[model samples]
Target: MPNDSPELNHEVTAPRAGTAREWELFVSEDATESPRHVGSVTAPTREAALERAELHVGRDAATLWLCPADEVTRRTAETAALSNR
Candidate 1:
């Protein structure tokens, strides 16, 4: 369970004028049957995000996915639904 915090200060101007940002975390296989989420300290670099993920996975080889913030929720839902069946 690592804390994921990314410091991004970028603004977007358009029809939906707002701040454009992303939070990076790692999706790794859990030691137990249950799924666990671990986040790293806020980093503005992709390298930092990948580093965080590697830390969680430890020495094991893993498939890492750098999903967008919006996709996070969707993917979670899909996983949950499939697992529940």
Candidate 2:
């Protein structure tokens, strides 16, 4: 059976109750390079988040940083400041 005439749809939902907080992990392999976002961890507390981050994303990393996703501020292309061209 070949069924190729269908639409694929996806929906995003908010975090659940017990595990409500999400922490983003930043991975740095060298001192000369700035850390970059590697992955995310969902946990009820920061300690668990840190542990999860270290186990998941920091296995081979030099350093890892975990911050609450809600506390972190980000600037997208739409909200970023424009420089003189």
Candidate 3:
């Protein structure tokens, strides 16, 4: 009998050894506003990403969000225009 399990069907993946991961930083100035991408940082872990972000852009930010660059999708107007052709 074939075992059918959703959890078992998924493959786990991790960054390669000694590779630095890029993290995107977002900052919001106040509670009423949404966070905007300010810059990116390359680090080995989330903690290090936060420290880098704080040093660069988090000093006056009301909130900060750090997301792995690979996990975020971005498309710019220039790219969009090119794709239309």
Candidate 4:
């Protein structure tokens, strides 16, 4: 059987007052295509993030996905090399 596993990284932190948290925006123009990372937004809350995303890119997207930047674990090629050591 194939291993059906989901990537897990659930750590989320609250944004401080007067500070904004980064949100990753993914949008799909149509149902046939997968959502692609378009850009990012800085907001104090999830609701604000969605609002900003909609204003900027959601108007033409069929679907939208907003992910907290803190929740994402990004690894660059250089970092990947170091991790393999």
Q: Which window of ten consecutive residues has the lowest lDDT sum in model 3?
A: 9-18
Candidate 4 residue-wise lDDT at 77: 77
**Which residue runs does candidate 3 get wrong by more than 4 Å?**
1-18, 76-85
Tens-place lDDT digits, model 1, residues 24-66: 4555463443343554333455676566667766665344555
Model 4 lDDT per residue over 3-70, tens place: 55554444335554348888999999999999999988999899999999999894799999999987
Order candidates by lDDT, high to low. Answer: 3, 4, 2, 1
Each candidate structure's count of clashing pairs: 5, 0, 0, 0
lDDT of 2 by residue, 1-85 (tens): 6556545343235664554698989989977778999988889899988889988974678888899988888775667664432
- Local accuracy of candidate 3 as per-residue lDDT tens digits, 1-85: 7668998776445544458888989999999999998988889999998899999894689999999989997677765785676
lDDT of 4: 0.84
Q: Quantify all predictions' global Cα lDDT against the true fold.
A: 0.49, 0.80, 0.85, 0.84
Off by over 4 Å in 4: 1-18, 78-85
The lDDT, on a scale of 0 to 1, for candidate 1 is 0.49
Q: What TM-score, over all chains together, does every model reach?
A: 0.35, 0.72, 0.66, 0.66
Mark the regions of model 2 whose C-alpha exceeds 4 Å error after superposition. 1-13, 16-18, 82-85
Candidate 4 positional error at 21, Å: 1.1
What local lDDT score does residue 77 receive in model 2, on the 0 to 100 scale? 62
Candidate 4: the clashing residue pairs are none
